[model samples]
Target: MSRLYGDPIEVWTRDGEPTQFVWHDRLYLVRRVLDHWVVAREWWKTSEGDPGERRFWRVEASPGREVGSYELRFDTAGSGWLLMRAWD
Candidate 1:
């Protein structure tokens, strides 16, 4: 099972893919990308030519220890990266 969180985090990306991220004062390096996909964003919000989509990445990461699974979301509105869910 996984727990949900909407905490904002700083993520470093290379070639449009996440390489590392910091959350709760700890840094996690992405070991592998488990999955990647996009979904439509909130329907209540609308903008010109905006498809309203949310970019998501499920990754296996580690903070210098055993790996864990994480779900991350990229805020399209420019708020930044968010730690959407985690499985320890």
Candidate 2:
């Protein structure tokens, strides 16, 4: 099992597939920080534009980790890069 030593993060995907993520315009390799079970589906929204079931993960790296306490969204129906939640 991979351990998180420095920072905490959250990542999302569709069907739990491995994907490449970019941070600060640089690409970083990503893997599940824990197990295959991470993400939680949105239960508050029932509209057509709401997000569906999402897989979550904690991506880690050096000082500047690619992802930080942010929620990522991957939709098979969209184009371009996936969307990432803002860091507070």
lDDT of 2: 0.40
What's the CA RMSD for each of the models?
2.1, 8.2
TM-score of each: 0.86, 0.38
Where does candidate 1 have its weakest 10-residue lDDT segment? Answer: 43-52
Residues 21-75, candidate 2, lDDT per residue (tens digit)? 5545554555434323334446465455554555433343222454434334444
Clashes in model 2: which pairs?
39-56
Tens-place lDDT digits, model 1, residues 1-68: 89999999999999988999999999999999999998886656766556466799999998898899
The TM-score leader among the candidates is: 1
Q: By summed lDDT, which 10 consecutive residues of candidate 2 come out lowest?
A: 3-12
The backbone clash count of each candidate, in order, is 1, 1
Candidate 1 lDDT (Cα, whole model)? Answer: 0.89
